[model samples]
Target: MPGFNSEVRKSLQKAFTALADHYGVPTERQHFVEGPPGKALADFAAHHRADVIVMGNAHRKGLGKWVGSTTEHVLNRVPCNIFAVMGAADQ
Candidate 1:
């Protein structure tokens, strides 16, 4: 299980690195955290006093609409700004 987790983490790191490069974000600014996405992200942002967080819409159905649990959770916990991008219309 630990090995599987490591492999998954490696894969995620690769993808994150590519995206960061594409966005012109430096490697020093990137952080790889463990634990639940919402809590981890919110805690990290809060601790670092992040100016803004850019995220993708979960596109949830019903009441949430485009907002998902993780995004909502982060929004509720974080004191920073968030820019949620809508997913593609076809998706």
Candidate 2:
């Protein structure tokens, strides 16, 4: 997490918290992750016996999308499933 922006990270976390809270989902059971998201997600799912991973994509274009995306990273390797939804591009 060196050179990481704490403010941005906190803001992103709050967004998830707010969404979960609205649906009465327990924050206590939520998890935070670092490093490669695909590996972390797959490992967490396997450990927890989770049936699926739900995520949003910023819909990267051109080079970054072709080079490799987190979505592609986990698609074939995960033990379970992934449900990716489209969202506005990251600013």
Candidate 3:
């Protein structure tokens, strides 16, 4: 639903702002892009010529690790290096 998408966007924006503030990241350095996760990250990194993309990954094990992970997709598509932190599997 459009309403649901709007709510999610607002929630993400709020969380982004909060984290940026807590980390002392300037507003100009903070970006809240709305798109498919992997594609958005890849495109942003390429456009900005980023040296590295730091992200959280739900580090999976075995066969599960090779399938349907945004981190994997970004790793393959992004032009820059990636530093992935292990996050909860449910992510």
Candidate 4:
């Protein structure tokens, strides 16, 4: 699972790089976050003085619902606005 996640991240990085290059945007300002979703997101918002937090809502079954512990935690703790993108499965 970790290997798969790593590959997915690499693929995302590649896609983001291509998009950024196409737009003449520097990648230095882009932040790739990989950590416990809730705490890490909160910390990032606080440190960066961010006004919004964007995240994907993975449609997980059973135990995965509880895994939203991160989202819930962040929603409760963070002072910024939260935007959640629903997964295709969720739609």
Candidate 5:
């Protein structure tokens, strides 16, 4: 995190907060996690005993199925169900 951009981190946190607020979800539970995205999420879920994991899939078309993304990485790591929402182009 030595070179991490605080501005971008703040922007992403704001976005997450706004999105959660738009859906009437509490922003208090939102987190701007670091480390490997999938691992971070998986750890969070496990720590919180989350019943399900909802995540966006960002792997592009040409990327092989095994070519990793946060969604795929957490599939084998977490115990809960995963609901992946693919981006428009990914679909």
Candidate 6:
């Protein structure tokens, strides 16, 4: 499970890097937090005083109902509007 998590993190880093390069976006300030989803998000928002929360709406089925457990938790706990970017199929 640790190996799988590492692989996923690596893949996400590579993808984010590519995206930043392609869009000319800076990644120097990017931060990744691994913790209780709701608390993590709330902490980030409180510390940064972020005006909005942007998240992906992965349309998973079965036991993975809702946007995602973490995302749902953040949405409920955070004191700001959420901007969910759904996949094409979600439409």
RMSD after CA superposition, every candidate: 2.5, 4.2, 3.3, 5.0, 2.6, 3.9
lDDT score, candidate 4, position 59: 86
The C-alpha lDDT values of all candidates are 0.83, 0.72, 0.78, 0.76, 0.75, 0.74
lDDT of 3 at 9: 77
1-91 per-residue lDDT for model 2 (tens digits): 4457999788877887888789888878767666677777777777888888887775577755432477777776677778876655632
Q: State candidate 5's TM-score.
A: 0.74
> How are the candidates ranked when ordered by TM-score, highest leading?
1, 3, 5, 6, 2, 4
Give candidate 1 misplaced runs (Cα > 4 Å): 1-4
TM-score of 2: 0.62
Q: Where is model 6 poorest over a 10-residue stretch in terms of lDDT?
A: 28-37
Q: Judge candidate 2 against the unseen true structure and give its global Cα lDDT, from 0 to 1.
A: 0.72
Which structure is stronger by lDDT: 2 or 5?
Answer: 5
Q: Which candidate number would show the highest lDDT if scored against the true structure?
A: 1
Give me the displacement of residue 83 in model 3, in angstroms.
1.0
Count of backbone clashes, every candidate in sequence: 0, 0, 0, 0, 0, 0
Model 5: lDDT of residue 50: 88
Local error of candidate 4 at residue 91 (angstroms): 0.7
The TM-score values for the models, in the order shown, are 0.79, 0.62, 0.77, 0.61, 0.74, 0.63
Q: lDDT score of model 5? A: 0.75
Better of 1 and 4 by TM-score: 1
Q: What lDDT does candidate 6 reach at residue 31?
A: 63
Ranking by lDDT: 1, 3, 4, 5, 6, 2
Candidate 4, residue 91: lDDT? 62
Q: Using lDDT as the measure, name the better of candidate 1 and candidate 6.
A: 1
Off by over 4 Å in 2: 2-19, 61-68, 88-91
